[model samples]
Target: MRFEGKVALVTAAAQGIGAAVARRLADEGASVVVTDLQEDKLGEVAAGIGARALPLRVDVTSRDDVDAAVAAAVERFGRLDVVVNNAGGCIVQSAPEDTTDDDWRAQLDLTLVGASRCIQAALPELVKNRGNVVTISSVNGLAAFGNIEYSAAKAGQIAMTVNYAARYGSLGVRFNVVAPGTIRTPNWDNQPDTLERLSKMYPLGRIGEPEDIAAAVAFLASDDAAWITGHTLPVEGGVLTGPTVLNPALSKKEYPGH
Candidate 1:
């Protein structure tokens, strides 16, 4: 068990990648604290993950809420071994011109600021245990993928990870970011042919599952990656590697070596 006798706290863990992460950690023997604004859904996920899971209602946008949640996890688990800052999303989809000040701030507050708040609140405990932090970034963060505000916030997280790692490495704490591509979650639900279209963009020819992200999160949070820190691991099915498209005309053209 990679996480035996360890404690992991995950935010936005009611569903999607967060839930999968919580489950994966718990299955590997960590006592996981799963939190989200959706208390009912959070409870369901916790229950499914078994006795090793604790579900808490947490609104990451609030500093007080983040602090309280961290305190609660420490109180129950005795210590914090891992902190996964996963409470983030593209709350508003719009162009820079159309994006309201509120829209921009909301993305920052929820994704970038929220993760920072959680890290700040958990730093004392993390330092004590020499633990790790795994933040969920996105491929959009690494490029201009349309969702302007969200992409910017995600990019901010990558910066945060590197700077934090540099600041806290001597203290025996590690920080890393996982940049996922188009994950198949409820966010894509009812969007006609959305998954199919997005799948074509990845070299793998399929969209990612929540569990795929979970597996990467687990590895980063474990001792296997002990020497790894201040890094952004792209679990985006090679979308950021190169073009997935193939044209018959382009393929037919070959060098003299052929």
Candidate 2:
């Protein structure tokens, strides 16, 4: 077990990437604390991880909740070695001109400020234990991929990570960002063939799975990446390298091969 005797706290652990990360960490021998606003779903996720997980209800937007959750984690595990800031979402998807002040605020609060609060609350224990942090950013954050508000906030997260690394490296704490590109999750459930369509956007010819992001998080959280800090690792399936061609269906002419 690479993480034997280690303690980890993962925010937004109810489903998707967060759930996968929680399970991966627990499997690697870490006692993990899983937190989310979805109490029932969070409980189920924690239970599925077996006894090594402690489930907590946390509204990351609330400093009180974030602080209490960190306190609970330390009280239960005695120490904290890693904190995964995976709790964020695109609250509203709209064109830049149509986006409202509330939309921008919500996105920033949840995706950016919320992560900051978690990092802040977990800082003391992390500093004391020489812990590390891994934040979940998006490809949109690194590029003009759309989702204006969400993308902006996610970019801010990346900035925050680099700054944290620079400021806390002396304190024995490391920080990194994981930018995922079109990960296949429940969010796309209602859209027909969404995964297949999105797969065309990646050079790998397939969209990423939650485990893909989880693996990256685990690497950055472990000693394997001890020398790595102030880095934004794009876990995207080569999407950031180049642009994909337009959809074949949208083409006016088809090649002779078909």
Per-model CA lDDT versus the true structure: 0.92, 0.92
TM-score for each candidate, following the candidate numbering = 0.94, 0.93
Candidate 2, residue 251: how far the Cα is off, in Å: 22
The candidate maximizing TM-score is 1
The residue-by-residue lDDT of candidate 2 on 72-153, one tens digit each, is 9889989999999999998887778988899888999999999999899989998999999999999999999878888899
Those runs of model 2 whose alpha carbons end farther than 4 Å from true positions after fitting are 246-258
Q: Where in model 1 is the C-alpha error above 4 Å?
A: 246-258
Superposed Cα deviation of residue 121, candidate 1 (Å): 0.5
Q: Tell me the lDDT of candidate 1.
A: 0.92
Residue 178 of model 1 has an lDDT of 95
